[model samples]
Target: MDDAANPLRIPPQMSVYADKHNLFHLLQRMLTGLLIDQPEDPISYLVRLLQAADVPKIMLLGPPAVGKHSAAKKLSAELGAVHVTTDSLLEDQSELSAEARQYALTHQEIPAELLIQLIKRRLNSVDCVDKGWVMEGVPQTFLQALRLQQAGVIPQHVVMLEAPDDVLLERARGRLVDPLTADVYHQTFLWPADDAVAQRLEKRRDLPEEQRLADLQRYRREVTALTSAYQHVLRVVNSDQPITDVYQQVAAFVKTRRYYRTPRILLLGPPGSGKSHQARQLSEKYKMVDVSCGRLLRAAAADGSAVGDEVQPYLDGGTPVPDPLVLKVLDKRLSRLDCCSRGWILHGFPRDLEQVRSLQESQHRPNRVYFLEVTDDVCLERITLRATDPVTGERFHVVTRPAPNSEVHKRLRTRPEDGVDTVTQELRLYRKHTAALQSVYPDAVHIDADQDFHSVFEALESRLTAD
Candidate 1:
């Protein structure tokens, strides 16, 4: 394209002798180029192209688990911008005035006055003012959006991640959180690798189904008003597909351009299916972060936070933590990192259909799900031979990695449930709960785990790289 025809290209004369009139002319030419053979709304396209040089101030609106945060982070990284979320801002109350912190601690929800003050401070900060930013979890209501505009914190674009109510609920249900790190995980989709970490995970108690539905209904009501108020710059994306696909759509809308998206992979299987091993290998090979929900949960339980306090009782009793609680823990962890920018391997989660629904609802659905298939006999054998270190919770195989001496063997412990009878019982439970996943995740790539490690790993490598 010629300089005048290229939206991103500026002619030398325009730069050296630019005046208000010349700048206007340049913008006019860029608009004409952007509009050429384009199907997008002209005004919206023009607005986005005009803001290309300025710091991006974007607002991401969506129900919980709709991947708004993920999209925001990805866009921020892509544009060398900052990613801001109200939740993160609130979590570190030390930055706020004493009165604001006190009020935030006492109230179930921060009042608009307090929120506005904090948000204004954040927007005026150096990072947001100098660089662009993708902001999430604020301006929840039409009034809030207007208030932000009144405070001179206007967004150039307002993007909404849209999904069905049923999908939202399922995603809400599968949410897991690690109270320690505030990482989020989906039960059927993404989890930690260690069982101990799984033990500390609890469903997001704050997002019960009824509450989620209510919030969703409220969002629908507010969105009607908000979208109408900001229709010129509003963009809506259907987020029911895989997260990467949804991100691509959002990115295109944001830049008024297109780019390739990285894939997020999820590994699923019963106990002893070797999902963790594969996740580690894949993470190393692809430079993807390995989020082991189980490890996060365990850390949370040990971390002595409120979430850990709640999880200890369940772990002590050997009972499963509620799905909602687990989701909450995972959510916290995911929020703290750059999962979208780096991509990730989700391991040891979504042991049931409810978890699968949660993954879908949350907009954190995986690009590909690998279900490691192993026979009951093989799983039982692996479980039966497993030994644990009481102090460290490390696992050892009696045959493969036995203690080096009698003194070391004396210190090793085996779970009472790892006995042959208990192992059989566990296999039956796995079959009862997880076997149906084969049908549920019809698109999942299945690999035989009963084979030697090299064979199984090779199959996985081939399938993953083929894409």
Candidate 2:
């Protein structure tokens, strides 16, 4: 393999992976036969010609502002590969065509179809595909990575960046963004002395420290799932190290791409309850993807693909997509996220005797299964008040005025399964199945979801929170 084909750059936390030499630089030299031209640059490039191997691509995963984006971009510049960030992708109007627009409007997400299309577009670009690229914040989940791979967008390597909780919290707190201009300024380094604009800028005091901690913890949880999925293809890096040391480690990890691991997960729940909401909230909180079966099935249909054939029937039937089919679809979805080292939220599937048995049989079980115990009544009420988007078919509140024309109470009608009478029937079914399900897990908590959402969440939170 020609070293010129692949690039190696030092990242911020290289000391943790200390072996004989910097992995990125060593690999770069081995491949290209040329020493990195500029070691001082944040991004270093090494390409020599053992000469014909495809330059392996690398992804830097870490919580926001952990320098994942900064490191990847620097490396890209040094390596001469196009650097892609989530913000860049988000702002690309050309990529946000009618389909993508509708998806954005409806789902509150960059739909899988849109993502596949975008990856394809990026892969075909003269800069990205031909010379190779360094990407950050793209495949945030097992499913997203799988979508890219299934679409043939596999990365040659992934760098999993981890930091201590204290350092992460400090980083989060020190970070500041100009809300209006979307400009970021780190208090310690970017702030200008005696600059009126900087002085006038205020920290988001409304967002309490606890919230920041919550956000960081949530990110860790999500990333844990993603890491699991792509464990085999990922190289773990501790980003808490000094910037120069970090880069050296990242470069070194890139050199040993084949020695990485892929990640996996097993999340279970029912829909219209708190499953999807919690899944997403937790995923964002953890930095993992919430892979909902319903969402996947819809994406398949929208993409006009064969997966739709099996999924469309369940949707049309107005019934829950079966556990077997859900798992099957998700099994496909899992293959997309090149790595699940970050973890994911498995929403709405794997319910009842068959689903559980099927899940166990497949041997793809969750590290810990959480049975969200929402009463049928509560689930029904929530669905009734939430309006769904016609395009993405996502649910949201149709904020309206209060009292008569004053508006505030108008809402999207509930699904028939969520109607009062249906709820009663469902509750009866749930009661009957609870024993059987609990029998499978002697320790599963039977939460009283009859209480407020916050209260129920508090119960779950206590379990995960350190005493």
Name the best candidate (by TM-score): 1
**What is the clash tally of candidate 1?**
48
Model 2 spans > 4 angstroms off: 1-273, 319-324, 380-405, 408-412, 443-467
State the C-alpha lDDT per candidate: 0.70, 0.58
Error of 1 at 31 (Å): 26
Worst 10 residues of 2 by lDDT: 1-10
Which lDDT tens digits does candidate 1 get at residues 75-181?
A: 88898877787665665545465556666577456667778878777765667767878888678888887776565565667789998888877777788877765
Q: Which stretches of candidate 1 lie over 4 Å from their true place?
A: 1-260, 388-395, 405-407, 465-467
What are the per-residue Cα lDDT tens digits for candidate 2 across 157-261? 788778878877677677765665444556863563457667666565444787777667767767867775565567778777776788888877676636321
lDDT of 1: 0.70
Worst 10 residues of 1 by lDDT: 12-21
> What's the number of clashes in each of the models?
48, 86
